[model samples]
Target: MEYGCYVCNKIIKTGEKFTFTKEGPVHMDCFVAAERKKVPEGKAEYLRNLSMILDYELTMLVSLLSLKSEDKETSELIRRRINAIEKQAGETTGLIYNL
Candidate 1:
């Protein structure tokens, strides 16, 4: 029988299967590591605050760039540059996978 790893999403061929907090299946090795890294729900507020802080920093950077002078030619260049960076970032930071 085969089982699926819930964390890394790899297929478990012969090792023991473990269940995640979200009720997903994983290989024992993967699950153990994930469990070690788990954080308590009470501390989630700290992570949320950190995310908000990072988002504010990103917004400030964009605002500062928007304050710079721009003509049509420069605008097009900026647009293309932003698009390329966004595309690469999206590819590297994709959030979903199915098993």
Candidate 2:
């Protein structure tokens, strides 16, 4: 069975070093990156802060899509970028729901 990295949402290849959280297995680098991130003052604060970031990312993605790039590779890359951002936004929403 293939496991996914929590941060990148990419497959964690066999034999890779990872750490387990209450959520699931995450690559060591991903875990460290999360650890180094600044903690919010409170749940409401965290949600508000993340919401702003998510909003900006979504706005950027929408703007890019409006340009209607003809390059297949560029379009595919944008789709992947949007997917990754949406996934992270969902995870953040889940955290708020849990609290």
lDDT of each: 0.46, 0.60
Candidate 1 displacement at residue 61 in angstroms: 8.2
Task: State the number of backbone clashes in model 2.
Answer: 0
- What TM value does model 1 have? 0.31
Question: How far in Å is the alpha carbon of 54 misplaced in model 2?
Answer: 2.7
For model 1, the superposed segments whose C-alpha errors exceed 4 Å read: 1-68, 95-99
| Cα error of candidate 1 at position 50, Å | 19
Taking the tens digit of each residue's C-alpha lDDT, what string does model 1 give over 1-26?
A: 56677678777654232333345655
Best by lDDT: 2
lDDT of 2 at 12: 87
Error of 2 at 97 (Å): 2.5
lDDT of model 2 at residue 16?
Answer: 59
Clashing pairs in 1: none
Candidate 2 deviation (Cα RMSD): 11.1
The 10 consecutive residues of candidate 1 with the worst lDDT sum are: 90-99
lDDT of 2 by residue, 20-95 (tens): 4578767655654464364444655665555556456545545654555789998898788867765664564445
